[model samples]
Target: MIKEITCISCPNGCEMSVEVVENKIIRVENNKCERGISFANEEIFNPQRMLCSTVKTSDPKNLRLPVRTDKVIPKNKIFEAMKCINNIVINKNIQMGEKIIENLLGLGVSIIASQSLKINSNNV
Candidate 1:
């Protein structure tokens, strides 16, 4: 089967066509750069997309925080990964790069604070 795509890795958005059999890319076409080729190969085999979502916090005033992996996890493990992130409850006065969940779902990914959050000490 042939799969076609418009590459989004750069501004050029090169139109690409790739051949796949049993989910493995055998041929790639129309890409003018290395990034497009890499993206096409990954898109066909071991396809992984990013996940971005909000996580709950222990502080009422700071109810949610944005979290994501620095790299993409396996596609099938996304939900399990999400579960790990969902259960996290960050405390007040958290700072950026603070670990929120460790080895999330055994995916070797961690959810962390992208920004600092401060909460009322008494309520939180």
Candidate 2:
């Protein structure tokens, strides 16, 4: 099976043509770097994607906080992962890189705060 993929490993965005046989990569073409080859192979077998989204926050002034997975998760699990993340409501100010959900969905990936969020004192 010949599959085409756009390499996201670098800015070049090399379009790749990968030949697979029984889940094994036989040939890779149109790749500029070695990383592209690896990216293409993974894309055919176990594709993954970084998750970035906002979670509800307790502070009214800051209704949502941006968060992201520390590592790439399986592409098929993105929706399930988002469901787990959406259940969280941070009650205190959070710092960037703080782990919001550890080992998210048992995928060995952590969902971390994308930016620092301070408390909103104006709320009575």
Candidate 3:
């Protein structure tokens, strides 16, 4: 089987084609660098993606705060991670880079606040 993929490891976005037989890569083409080969293999065998989304915050001024995983998570677990993200409400004054969810789903990745949220004066 032959598969085509676009490398996202860099801005170049090298388009690559791979020839596979019985779940093994036989050849690769259209790669500009060694990273392209690695990207294709990982994409085909174990795809991963970084998660980024907004979560509810306690502050009225900023009812929602942006969050993201510190590292890439498995593609399959993205929806599950989203579920965890959606269920949480940040009741604390969260600083940028604060951990929202540590070791999310035991995948060794933490969901962190992408932006800071300060407590509303009215709430104090």
Query: Which candidate wins on lDDT?
Result: 3
Writing each residue's lDDT as its tens digit, candidate 1 over 10-50 gives 88999999988986778788999888889887666667866
- Write candidate 2's Cα lDDT for 1-124 as tens digits: 8988999998899999898898789899999889988898688788999999999987888899999999999999999998998899988889999999999889899999999989786761
Which RMSD values do the candidates have, in order?
A: 2.1, 1.5, 1.3
The clash count of every prediction, one per candidate, is 0, 0, 0
lDDT of 3 at 80: 95
Could you tell me every candidate's TM-score relative to the true structure?
0.81, 0.90, 0.94
lDDT of residue 123 for candidate 3: 68
- TM-score of model number 1: 0.81
- Pairs of residues clashing in candidate 3: none
The CA-based lDDT of model 3 is what? 0.92
lDDT (10s digit) by residue, model 3, range 66-102: 9999999999999999999999998888899999999
Q: For model 2, which pairs clash?
A: none
Which 10-residue window of candidate 2 scores lowest in summed lDDT?
A: 115-124
